[model samples]
Target: RPGKEPEVDLPYYHPRAPSAEVEMTAYVLLAALKTEPAPSQEELSFSSLIAKWISSQQNPNGGFSSTQDTVVALQALSQYGAVTYAKSGAASKVTLRSGGEFQQDFQVDATNRLLLQRVPLPQVPGEYSTEVSGEGCVYLQTSLRYNVQPMQEDAPFTLHVSTIPETCADSKAHKVFDIGINVSYTGERNGSNMVIVDVKMLSGFIPLKSSVRKLERHPIIERTELSTNHVLVYLEK
Candidate 1:
């Protein structure tokens, strides 16, 4: 009796699977780029392709998805200029404005500890915020709003964010610093559904690395594989 307790049936629950829309969209974009001809070899533009795709996905309120789809879309669009595509009757310009520039100053103390003076960035519509500070560590915060629906201002939510540093290699410097923000969602039922449409910031650093090694190795394609009819057979069979 002490070793064997009554077997009780617990509720079966499954967490939602990861979204594949982002990956699928990216694959489609790449395929489109490969099949579509460019106006000129010098004029090849991935941005235009991405912009077109993003435009189709944009919600009526100007916000994108909070899922990976949104992340890939934003990253691809960011690679291009402010605009991605132009239609006949639509606005001739598509400007992607996150907000004002992020500013930071660096200083060194007598103890050689690096000091960072980060200027507070103002909040923007459809944004989020996060902050962190500690010894040799930093934190990140962000907010994003759902463009598909209007949310109450007092609702609780979260955002997707990542931090990266700008490189100083061209300047002969060994390091650089930067951060990033994106949209995400987090809330409990009956709590809040509002997405924070405003600016959010995260803090971190770039530790200098002396020796760089490739994290991934490229596979070698043999000459025989390229020259033989066996290539097709090998690929298919």
Candidate 2:
């Protein structure tokens, strides 16, 4: 219905309010889209919209809602970009303006499509607007980060981390140490979503796999993984 002359949306309603089955269908659809060859205009148009929606779901870190979704969505969208490579040799002018005083322009075309173009804003607290008037796709990302200290009780999630055998306590016992982690979900929902904890090992030190296995057996831990320099822990909430 998406590419129709008078388009109508697909009904997403189910007999019951919510179901995991419906959510699983999303992955299946993404997998099918990844393998699909959109030869026809209709399929291409629909897939383009799906790709846009997936891009919109990207987090500030340039990933989708979750690690798994990010991997699958990117695989599908990467293929989409390859098929839609510009052939008309079109260009887009991206104009950034703030309060009619600060302005900058960038040109995007096939030759420089994959290049990163950065424009620094002079003003810290300024209202800005952007205008794009040409054909091909242009992805723009702005980075501004700050730290906030939330009140202890008001924080959505709380973490307490410590290590056994304090540095002052031992010389020979320093060969191995135990790390303790305590986390709590304090949000309004029943619980938080799946959480990924990434621990980077100090130089010349690697986490013991046996210790990681002990975490995997914990009732609350969903999974644990070991990589070259990082230990990843997944928690299901």
Candidate 3:
């Protein structure tokens, strides 16, 4: 099969950091906003939320991952701001609350609107709420950072890697050995997206070019790449 785009089904904005997916999503939202019929309040609300989220991904240098993403994100954010801007001017306050345990306030005013202010989240694995009052367009965004360890109990996928020729019974085995890889998906879904396997060669060893070409021709593999210190195998789902 040929290469294709991935499908993101998670409940979060994205599974990883800012990338082309985020840029495309922002463009899609902008397209939705420009449709013939006016969007419902619910859709507008959702779009606003997405716009703020994209804004939060902005780099300190005032750009996204690339120039294209930066342009689209800025266009979407500007449009959202125009649509939701309040006529009256007043200082706005954002409140971050986690259940009944913690509460913090962030004030946004003309004096501090251009400045960047941030506070660390007090807890992890907690439900938090953001509310804004006396607003003239106060954007509040929460970022989530967490580690993803291998799933021990109910992993969606499993990988096994081994090398042939346990012993140097054959002289050539010392110089070149075939690598064996077995992967299985046991998740609820039919399968996963594309998987990339990076096999790093030993300091003095490298993959054989002919071997890489053979792997690249396999039906299950999309492409193969050989570098100075590693071999990359692209596998299809």
Candidate 4:
């Protein structure tokens, strides 16, 4: 077992071990220290010292970087509520402009709210626009559109109904019904009306009573006992 590359338990690696980037190393060490149970008073003091050291390296633009450092240090400090070089202290403010451009400023604040203002935009004339506000946190912004069309007075119609087996074994077969309504009007360029048709499926050869007196006159036809599996109905007018 001497040269057998000691079964290195990868997960228990040291918290203070150097990473490829100093910022990443500090972040990982801080995270580990935060999670470790019953850390000694000396360890706590060391963690505070490192936090201050990382805070000192904060960048003016809210992003930290060194020539040899792969990870940005200011961003890491922002996550831990530490003020790097940000005038506002703990929050990173990002400003976005048209054409997919953005700028970021970092600040450390004890209160979480980060107020950003004075964002300038290029003006476009004669275009109607409105902004909507909502309560709770503003996590995202998006645009939406809605359109409405006039209903048709005269249109063709179709109706269908059937019984099918339920997916679950313990349940009985269910009578599934679907009504397809299609209406088209020709004269004067009028919109189509939605015709609501009532459908009924009788189990046996006996005909079921229907509120609709006759299918043809009512702009609909009710077909019953067409087959053992299902029944079909449609608008006769």
Candidate 5:
């Protein structure tokens, strides 16, 4: 429905209803358009409305009503800044030295140019100084990419988790105790949806066998693996 039209008008059933989700999605779309190498005419048309809606959702403290919406909106805005305002290509030189013990010089030019670099240095403890000079910009910040790692899975709805005991007992003599936990999902979804809750425990704690039970609702499957420190609870929406 988004791509079918250049602009979208959010429809609200009630005047007092919150529009965080719709506004956040539109902010993400606007961010994508701002970061495009070359935006089309359709994307350009939605620019004004997207900015207006996103700004309207911002609170006085510079945050959204919901944590998830804030995260998505900030991510979109940051991506736009990184792509749109990238430094221009020009000649540059960077020199680094650590207490005069180690020194390295880097030059960026047409013949000797690099998109990535790795400079191995010996372990030394001292104050370091870097001097960047030339016509262009020098970026020292590094981007960490985890390609093989799995993307974090978000809960389909909002979750509120609470435990009975605020502080854990400090003991080492084979302690056995009872803990009560309450989990509430606040997102609206159909009854046929599936919710998978994964719990991982820290070292030295093991879940008791046949201890997991739903006091209020029924679950499809409940399992625990002590070896890997994992507990999985699956429930229907």
Candidate 6:
């Protein structure tokens, strides 16, 4: 069967740190903005919320914890600033104040809208606030567009099967057999990809997994529905 390309949503939270999740969410939002045609107001609101969440997770050092997290978070913030939180053409100022002791301001304009502005927050145990009154706010709308490909017609493939022990050793009624399956793909382009095989057993015969091996790639036993008397195996190359 042919594969499909589908767009998946970014989760609001993940098992990792909040910063990593925020970065992933930002990447998804930016990707949607680029690929989608139009977005709804609700989506804009949700994306804004996610951006604010990402901002909140910033550490006093102005970066995330691990190297990977920091790199992704910074990239996400840069994308958000470029595609979502861009400033207007008119001159605007954003202020940051902490514990009534620290204060700073940044000037923004449409020419530098794509630039990411970072304000390091102090590690002091106190309150901090940011105020922005400008011609534009930090919000944008985007849609996620993607398509799924239809299954293609199956092409002819080669399969070789052999039974071990040549014949059943014990009584015919209770004897078991070991089946060896060899799948060969001589197709072009990467030589091979992935193939799925289905094996159905009759009313009296049973399948056992005493030994299983593959040559070119690993085999995955995806489905083993004993109730349905069907077994599905996946081979990757």
Top-TM-score candidate index = 2
Candidate 5 global lDDT: 0.55
Name the candidate, 4 or 5, with the larger TM-score value: 5
Q: Which ten residues in a row have the lowest lDDT in candidate 5?
A: 8-17
Indicate the TM-score of model 6.
0.35
Off by over 4 Å in 3: 1-67, 75-89, 150-237
lDDT of 3 by residue, 1-237 (tens): 234535654444443345686688789778767755677788887887787678767764667888888888888877776665654557889888888679888898877875677788787767888888875766555666555565568878788988787666999988998878788888999888998988898667888888889887789899988898888888898
User: Better model by lDDT, 1 or 2?
Assistant: 2
TM-score of each: 0.21, 0.49, 0.41, 0.22, 0.30, 0.35
Looking at model 3, the pairs that clash are none
- Give the residue spans of candidate 4 off by over 4 A: 1-21, 31-34, 38-41, 66-237
Can you list the residue pairs that collide in candidate 2? Answer: none
Q: Rank the candidates by TM-score, best first.
A: 2, 3, 6, 5, 4, 1
Q: Please identify model 6 stretches exceeding 4 Å from their true place.
A: 1-20, 27-35, 85-87, 95-106, 111-131, 137-237
Tens digits of per-residue lDDT for model 4, 1-237 = 123333534432322223244666566645635644545667656655665666444433333455444254444444344321234333333334343333433232335444533333333322323222322222222222234565666533333333333142433323332223334345444543343343333453322224223444543343323334343444333
If the candidates were sorted by their lDDT against the true structure, best first, what order would they fall in?
A: 3, 2, 6, 5, 4, 1
Candidate number achieving the greatest lDDT relative to the actual structure: 3
lDDT of 1 by residue, 67-184 (tens): 6666665555544332323232321111222335443333323243323233334654424233323232221212233334445574344456454534555553334433344443
Report the C-alpha displacement of residue 141, candidate 4, in angstroms: 32
lDDT of 5 by residue, 165-203 (tens): 444554532454444444556545544466567766546
lDDT of 2 by residue, 102-161 (tens): 899999987888887988888876789999998888887676655556546677888888
**Candidate 5 C-alpha error for residue 80, in Å:** 34
CA lDDT for candidate 2: 0.71
